[model samples]
Target: MNFDEFTGTVQHRLELPGTGEAVRATRATLTTLGERIQAGEATDLAGPLPMEVDFYLTGAVAEHGQRFDWNEFLDRVAEREGQTAPDDRADVAHHARTVVAVAAEAIPAGQLDQVRDQLPADEGWGNLFELVEADGAQAE
Candidate 1:
């Protein structure tokens, strides 16, 4: 998908007020994800995405494979998203999941799976993929 379509879909999925919010959501989620996974993997995942959007995955961070857990992941995303309230974590997670689901559709086949492999499922990080998993199941 192109930049406009990608952000539009994210806005529609999250019911956000506008494309700006969608862009922020996408950036917050992908940037955090880029930090958590390896640099090479992040580059590969960014490959099929729109250049505007892919930068969130590759260019935003100074380094990758930082080895943070799910809570830290959410914290970084919340910080980037300007969600300061402690109570906003659930909403943050939901927004991240929505962004990632949209990204899963945009990236090439198996790219998300590679990203998934880097995150530990037992650590509750796998929850990020809930929407993607549901979509895949429905497709099957």
Candidate 2:
């Protein structure tokens, strides 16, 4: 999928009113994700994505990603998404899951595997990709 389709699918999947909200969710989730994933993994994962999608992960932090768990990761994404209200938790999880699911559809399987495998195994960070994998499985 190209940028338009990618964003459109995000909007449709999330039942958002327009591409505008999808773009907002995508940018927030993807950029914040860039901050959590290793620079090299980010680059490799970005390689197969559309230019617009890849842009978010392109200038990843110089250091190897920060040590943050899945909940904090969601918090950052929710914060970046401008929906920090106490009642926004459900919306935040839905946004994160939806955007990542749609982007996962556009990414090449090989690259996706590299990403899932490359992430740190010691931490519960596996939850990061769990949604994407589950989404992919459901699609099949």
Candidate 3:
């Protein structure tokens, strides 16, 4: 439901190769989001939630030494790296942005239904996000 329970469930249930570190990184990112919200440094619409989630995922990917096509978009938008000027890259950025926006909103809703709807069907981070959503909903 909350961060602690969500993290705990991930630590227990998920069996990804590097889920442990991912779980830890996720918690840290969520904490940062909470802090930013408290400080009024960000809002849900400005895309802080998705940006933070990607930032957290980027770190986890680097830490695990895993490669993903989405990494570049994560870097370009989340890390504010070089502009993605080409038409294809622009499309990638747009898709990632939408994914982030949905996931971010689901995180706050803390409902399994909402999280599952937002998560990608690919079954890694998406599954973990769903787990958090489920736990959050159960708590309520």
The whole-model lDDT of each prediction reads 0.88, 0.74, 0.36
- The TM-score between candidate 1 and the true structure equals 0.94
What is the lDDT, from 0 to 100, of the residue 122 in candidate 2?
Answer: 69
**Higher-TM-score candidate of 1 and 2:** 1
Model 1 segments beyond 4 Å from truth?
A: 137-140
The alpha-carbon deviation from the true structure for residue 121 of candidate 1, after best TM-score superposition, in angstroms, is: 1.9
Judged by TM-score relative to the true structure, which candidate is superior, 2 or 3? 2
Candidate 3 TM-score versus the reference: 0.26
Worst 10 residues of 2 by lDDT: 131-140
Model 2 segments more than 4 A misplaced: 60-64, 118-126, 137-140
Q: Tens digit of lDDT per residue, candidate 1, span 13-68?
A: 89999999999989999999999999999999898789999899999988899988
Judged by whole-model lDDT over C-alpha atoms, candidate 1 comes out at 0.88
Q: Give the candidate number with the greatest lDDT.
A: 1
lDDT by residue (1-140, candidate 2, tens digit) is: 68888888888888989888888888888887788777888887677667988888766344447667667877888887888898997787778777777777767666666665655676655655666877672222
| Candidate number with greatest TM-score | 1
